[model samples]
Target: MTRISTSIIYLILFFINVRFVKNQQTTNFSCEPRPTQADTTDKLQRLRAHLVNNNLFAYVIFSEDEHGSEYVQLYDERRAWISGFLGSAGT
Candidate 1:
């Protein structure tokens, strides 16, 4: 498929996943022991240093993989790893 078509497909899937998650009932299952403010600050500092060393301006962390699937592998949880938000709806 063309790149544009592939992108459209992914976009559609992402919206569907979002809608599904939003419609779900809430539970008391929280992502416990959320990262502290200091932890986030430290993570950002380290990430900034890495970006500078690599000559990069910024980094984009997403909650989904290439296929826009909400159910991702552990390796694909960059958003949750960095932000400590494990929700299925938003990152």
Candidate 2:
């Protein structure tokens, strides 16, 4: 009975430690400003031309949201346009 109780205590401590470590992890991510539409357009146009020359299809998507207000979406088109990565929370 004593050994069983000790095992349970160890299991509880292990779970608590796991939870604490998980909670301490940082959730922040940031990126540099995106490029202008003209820049993106120029790059996309070049990419499209290359694709057409190679007989390939090119697809692209850009998105942005307003900054400062969490209520608004930031303008992140340049980030996505150049990096091809999207922030789920618009950070």
Which number leads on TM-score?
Answer: 1
How does candidate 1 score on lDDT? 0.62
Colliding residue pairs in candidate 1? none
Among these predictions, the greatest lDDT belongs to 1
Model 2 lowest lDDT segment of ten = 57-66
- What is candidate 2's local distance difference test score? 0.48
Give the runs in model 1 whose Cα sits over 4 Å from its true position. 1-38, 73-75, 88-91
* lDDT per residue (tens digit) for residues 1-91 in model 1: 9856765676666666655544554434544554553235457567757866796554656567878784799888877778666677543
**Positional deviation of 58 in candidate 2, in angstroms?**
3.5
Question: How do the residues 1-91 of candidate 2 rate in per-residue lDDT, one tens digit apiece?
Answer: 5845755665666556655534443433364445732234456456656755786443323233444343334344555565455565322
Candidate 2: how large is its RMSD?
20.5
